[model samples]
Target: MTLERITLAGGCFWCLEAVYEHVRGVHRVESGYSNGAHPSPNYEQVCSGTTGHAEVVRLDFDPAVVSLRELLEVFFTIHDPTTLNRQGADVGTQYRSAIYWHTEAQRALAAEVIREANEHHGGRVVTELQPETNYHPAEAYHQHYYARHPDQGYCAFVVASKVDKFLASFKRLVK
Candidate 1:
C-alpha cells in the first residue's frame, strides 16, 4: 500500500485529530505544531502566538483508500476555512487554516482544492497552502485527545461537533 503524508492546520489540532482518526484511509493522525518559527514549541508557547506556529495534524493515509480530494473535502466541512486566525472562540495565528504539503503533486492538488473550496465558501477560503516545515509533535496529552477525554468541555462542545459533521457528511469514509 502506498502512503502519503499531509499536515493541516485548521483551528485546533484536537478537532482535526479527532475527526481524521475516524477516517478510513488514515493510518495515523498526529496532533502537532507546524510551519512555526520555534524549533520545538510547546502547546503554551504556540498558544501564546509568539512561536509562529499553527496547531496542525500530520496525517498518514493511503490515497487508494481515501484520495486527497476526499480528505480535503472533509477538512473544509469540519472547519470554517473562511475565518482568519480563529475558529469559534479560539484565536491567534496558531488557530489559522493551512495545508502543509509534503510533495509537489500534493502542493498542486492543494491549490486546486483551495480554489474550489474558495468558490463554495463565497470566495473567502483563507486556508494557506505551504510546504511542511518546522513540525514538532504536541505533548502526549494532546494525542487522541477526543477519544481520551470525550467528556472534556472543549471536546464535548467543540471537537465533538466537528466529528459529528464528518460522520454525517462522509458516512462512507468513516472508519
Candidate 2:
C-alpha cells in the first residue's frame, strides 16, 4: 500500500489530532510544529508565536482507502478556515489554518479545495498553502492528548466538538 503524507494546522493541534486519529485511511497522526523559522522548536516556543511555527498534525494515510479530497473536506468541515490566525478562543499565528503539501498533486488539490472553500465562504478563507517544512514532533505529552485526557476541560469543551463534527459529517470516513 502506498501511503501519502500531509501536514495541516488549524487551531490547536490537539483538535486536529483528535479527529484525524479516527479517520479510516489514516495510519498515523502526529502532532507537531511546522513551516516555521526555528530549526527545532518545543511546544512552548511554538505557542509563543515568535518561532513562526504553526501547531500542525502530520497525517500518514493510504490514498487508496481515502482520497485527499475527502480529507480536505473533513478539514474544512471541522474548522473555520475563514478566520485568520485563530480558531474559536485560540488565538495566535500558531493556531492559524494552513495546509503543508508534500507533493505537486497534493498542492494542486489543496489549492482547488481552498478555492472552493473561499467561494463557499464568500472569498474569506484564509487557509495557507505551503510546501511542507521543518516539522518537529510535539512533546510526548501531546501525542494523544484527547485520548489520554478525554475529561480535561479544554479537550472536553473545545477539542471534543471538532471530533464530533468530523464524526457526524464524515461517518463514511470514520475508522
TM-score on alpha carbons, each prediction: 0.99, 0.99
**Model 1 per-residue lDDT tens digits across residues 88-168:** 999999999999999999999999999999988889989999999999999999999999999999999999999999999
Tens-place lDDT per residue, model 2, 51-163, is: 99999999999999999999999899999999999999899999999999999999999999999999999999999999999889999999999999999999999999999
Which portions of model 2 miss their true places by more than 4 Å?
Answer: none
- Residue 98's lDDT within candidate 1 is 99
Worst 10-residue stretch by lDDT in candidate 2? 161-170
Report the C-alpha displacement of residue 138, candidate 1, in angstroms. Answer: 0.2
Model 1 worst lDDT run, 10 consecutive residues: 117-126
